[model samples]
Target: MDDLFAPATGAWQRVSPRLATVRRIVIAAIAAPVVIAGIVLAVLLPDQRWIGAAVTVATLPLAAWGGVWAGHNQRTWGYVENADDLLVTRGVMFKRLVAIPYGRMQFVDVQAGPLARAFGIATVTLHTASTETAADIPGLPSDEATRLRNRLTELGESRGAGL
Candidate 1:
């Protein structure tokens, strides 16, 4: 388990912890309302108290599990930029590893959503001619994301991989 999807040469570079925080926040933002409404529904409609309790019961544990899963999932994400390719590895139960050659890179993009921007984190995506090779590394500090995009772009250009 410790070496699942481990890089071949160097150690994997992990994404920021803020990625987990942002995911947890999003989960809470979505789940909190459901929980609150469940309680409110229970209070307002005593005759349907079971329905409200069911909603709360069903959502609370799932949301809690999502929060924990977010943390663990974030920890699982990692990437490494090798001499000729970039490798990304993620997932827990069902793991994935992606390797994209610099010569095959079409472009690199950096994106940040409202919450990610607030946390100064961004996602770096690599586009290739092959749809199967497209990949994204999320929860990188904004600066790092920018740097990675730029570096990948430069590498792609040098390798004549630019589209």
Candidate 2:
């Protein structure tokens, strides 16, 4: 059982923090308009009262599910640099584990929103050879994200040179 979860050689290191409460708040804030719209639809839409009510009620579960999903999804940001590849695993239910060879790295980016800045957190996005398959490792400390980016960049470059 231990071996099943244990990482192989050059196992993953958690280089990022969990998404902060402020980040959750930011998401909720952005969702406020939709929430309000649902409420208005439930109240003002007379003919479709039942439908509107159902939709409004549905949002409650949706919001709860979304929060839990994000919380669990961002619970861990794993980075494993193997001899020839890097692997990142994230998400809880809809899990995604991405493997990228050093040669496949295009670039890396670090981003911080206002809420993240308030909480001193950042997100690191890794761009790979595939345009749509970017890795978004979020909710890290600003300094840590920067350090990881620099380290990963150096590693990628070194591997590129070796090849």
Candidate 3:
């Protein structure tokens, strides 16, 4: 059963280890404010103190769990490029494997949000004729993301020419 979720046997390139830190930071950034608000409300509103306290108590642990989960999830994301296709595998519980043929790629995009940019990581997205075929691989280093985008574009153009 564990083998089912393991990455395929090949030259699987793992995303940068720093991605885990980025995920934890993002989770904390989002969770901290909400928890703080709950705590403040608990102190300010005496009548609804119980509700606020409950919310604050419940959320803090959940937020920590989310950070841990994000770290683990980031570690799970990996990709491998073969002669004919690129394989991306992710998820720990509901594992998924997406195989995108080089010939099926229509375009490639590289993006980085403020948080990602600060972390020096970017996401590479692949577009195909079928919207369902489009895929994204996040948490790549900026330079690696650029190289991948260029490589995928080149491969897509050369391979898709026949299609």
- Tens digit per residue, CA lDDT, model 1, 1-163: 6565778889899999999999999999999999999999999999989888999999999999999999999998999999999999998898999999999999888899999999999999899988899999999999899889989999999999874
Collision pairs in model 2:
none
Every model's Cα RMSD, please?
A: 1.3, 3.5, 2.2
Tell me which of candidates 2 and 3 scores higher on TM-score: 3
After superposing candidate 1 on the true structure, give the runs of residues whose Cα lies further than 4 Å from its correct spot: 1-4
TM, every model: 0.95, 0.73, 0.90
TM-score-sorted candidate list, best first: 1, 3, 2
Which prediction has the highest TM-score against the true structure? 1
| Tens digits of lDDT, candidate 2, 1-163 | 3344445776667643446476457567756666777778878888887766776677667777767766666665676767776677775545567777777777888898877887788888888868656687777788878887887788778867221
- Model 3 CA lDDT for position 55: 81
Query: Can you give the lDDT of residue 102 in candidate 3?
Result: 96
User: What is the per-residue lDDT of model 3 for residues 60-160, given as tens digits with 9 covering 90 to 100?
Assistant: 89888987888788877889888888888788678787888999987888888988898899999988888777789999999999999888888988885
- Cα-lDDT of candidate 1: 0.93
lDDT ranking of the models: 1, 3, 2
What C-alpha root-mean-square deviation, in Å, does candidate 2 show against the real structure? 3.5
At residue 17, give the lDDT of candidate 3. Answer: 75
